[model samples]
Target: MLDAGLPVRAFFTDRRGGHSAAPYDTLNVALHVDDDPDAVAHNRVVVSEAAGALVTFLEADHGITVARIDEPTPRPPKADVLLTTTPGIALAAIAADCVPLLLNDPQTGAVAAVHSGREGLYRGVVDSAIAAMLDLRPSGAGAAGIRAAIGPAICGACYEVPENLRARVGRRHPVAVASTSWGTPSLDIPRAIETRLTELGVGPVLRHRHCTFEDTRWFSHRRDARTGRHAGVIVCEGPVGVSVPAPEDAAT
Candidate 1:
């Protein structure tokens, strides 16, 4: 678990400590990756244990859609962003190479877990999530009180892409445009996200420098095609007494 630098309980999961087999190995939290259903459930239970609350794992649609979680649910709606203000309800965003982003508003106690890929980042998922978080605050609340954490993902030095694709994403997010070590066009997704977070007025943005493509600790789809996925999880604390529910079936 990587510390998210927030007051609440928040961290990023790696490929360790669970019930999955090879490729998925252990601690794989994604259900859509053809891993064993029973194993995935067991892994989710492990994650929930770490979170100390019932987790609402989100399904990423690679878009800017945001789903609000008012209570703990086994299956949440398909969306790239999951937002919740309810305490004791943990939210998780699973990813292999895509950025697993976490946000928390200390003032409002609202938190969000985001799956930000190239498509979702270009489509303004960060902005969408920030807007939803601000909605839970006072009428004039700004993002200054919001804290963001960027988890492990494919770094710019390894994320080689076609020139045209780089140009397209660069048009909107110029910082995303980068050159790989071998002088090929690439996109620094985490760097671009950090830039966007600052541009949006969020503070204390904590970023994990671990690259999934380079580090074997985290899962990377680009590094291993049939690999498992990790998650960025955050818990919304409330009064003690609410019980956590069981994990659900594999998500489609």
Candidate 2:
């Protein structure tokens, strides 16, 4: 939806559409996973072309770092989430088994992309992103207009966690804890994210129903340790001063 007039254009890419091979298969977008740099670059181009914007990549390390799109220079800031008020620039975060969150303020046209796995979740990426968005667009006027979408991830049924992890997740999102097939505890990352968004007063929360682990169509690092990464991308719609045509028109 990048070309829409809404404040943000956002989408989560699956593993089915790129050029890669073997353990990484195809469409692996992560440069950190030991995938060939050429393949990764090609994959990134595919994502950008699909999103219709030049997506700025962020190095996510399970920490919170806020970035503005208008900045001329890039610094070494590692964060699991990135936010921007500037249009025409898209922000992207990477994930494999983790949860990717896309947020938008339709009124102000600001957006953010977040990568939150168990560690990032523990670090409060959701809370941090909400705080950053609110700070950029203060007052309930802009905050209340925010919309969020929680993308594909490892489902709780397939996401077995150790007792320590389970306990930590339970502390923040008790409802996400569930008994696993082996009778161990697991955490629903998406559920935790949804709860956090509700708590932060996000207007609408849409969830993708696919489980990366169970669905071979998507990449799952937990299921296959050598798998490539997928990206969640969001950008402000269109080039400066140029209106994007309606979807119906584009289809013609």
Candidate 3:
């Protein structure tokens, strides 16, 4: 597990130590990847144990949709961003190469887990998540206390893209436009996310240096097509199941 360097109990999981077979390997938490269902269940239980609470792993739609979790449930709603203020209810964002971002506001004890891919980034999923978190803030509260953790992902040096594709994403997030080590067009998604967080006044952003594509310790879908997915989990630890009024748009 990769520590997120925040006050809350937040960390990103690596693909190690669990009950899965080859391809999916061990510790694959994503059930949709065709891994053994019983094994996936066991792996999820392992992750929850690591989290010290039951984790609500998000199901990504690869969009900017946001959902608020008020209580633990058997099935989590499908959304790119999952927000929670209830204490002891952990939220997780599952990904391989895509960026798994965790956010927390010390002022309100609100936290979010975001699954941001190329499309989600281009479509402003990061902004959506921050907005959702801000919406959870009390009246007149500001965003100065919000902190972020960017987990392992495909770095710019390895995330090669077409020139046109790079141009397309660069139009909005210019910092994301980059060149791979081999001198080809690429996108630095993690760096771009850091920049966005800074722009949104989120301080002390901690970004994990490990690149999933280059590091064998973490699972990379680009490196292995049928690979398993890991997660970035953040725990909320104040109260439990207290319903904070959510914006209408937060519904999944």
Candidate 4:
């Protein structure tokens, strides 16, 4: 588990220490990836155990929808962002190449786990999550003290896209416009998210510099289509069903 460098019990998982067989190969936390159901269940329990709470996993749709999780449930809702002010409820965002972003508000003690990929970013998933988090704050409690952890993702150095697609996203997020190491049009999603957060005043972001496409430790769909998924998890500690940040997933 990669600690998000936050005071909370938050971390990103690697493709190690799991029960799933090859392809899904160990520690695969996703239930819809055509992996063995029994293996997926075991992996989920393992992750939840590591989190020290039953986690509510988001079934991402690559949209800006947000869901509030106050308690554990048999079925997690479908959304790109998950928000909670409750403790003892760990939230997880599963990913392969897209960005897994975690947020925590020190003052209001609210937390948000956002799933933002190229499509979601274009659709404003990050903005939706930030807006939702601000709503959870106390009266007049603004975005100050709101911290973020940007988990590993495909860096611009390797993420190549079509010229038109790159131009489209670049129009909205100029910082995202980039050229890959191979001189192809690319989008640096994590960097763009960081810039957006800073512009919105939700700062002090702790970025995990390991690129999923370059690193073999984490899963990367772009590297292998039939690969397993890893996760970024955060659980509340202040009170049960009460406070902290959480996680969600995004499709590539």
What residue pairs are clashing in model 1? 88-236
Cα lDDT tens digits for candidate 3, 25-129: 788989899999999999999989999999999999999999999986648888999999898889999999999999888767888999998999999999999
Candidate 1 similarity to native, TM-score: 0.93
For model 4, residues 1-252, the per-residue Cα lDDT tens digits are 788876678889889999999898898988888999899899889889998899888788899999999998758789998888887888888899899999887666677778889999989998899899888766666565578899999999999999999999999999999999999999999999988887787766778888999998989999999988898888876522333334321111
Poorest 10 consecutive residues of model 4 by lDDT?
243-252
Candidate 3 TM-score versus the reference = 0.93
**Rank ordering of all candidates by lDDT, starting from the highest:** 1, 3, 4, 2
Candidate order by TM-score, highest to lowest?
1, 3, 4, 2
On TM-score, who's better, 2 or 4?
A: 4
Rate residue 239 of model 3 by lDDT: 32
RMSD of each: 7.5, 5.5, 6.2, 5.0
| lDDT score, candidate 1 | 0.88
Q: What is the lDDT of candidate 4?
A: 0.85
**In model 1, where do residues sit more than 4 Å from their true spots?**
238-252
For all predicted structures, in order, the TM-scores are 0.93, 0.86, 0.93, 0.92
Question: Residue 102 in candidate 1 has what lDDT?
Answer: 94
Candidate 1 RMSD to the correct structure = 7.5
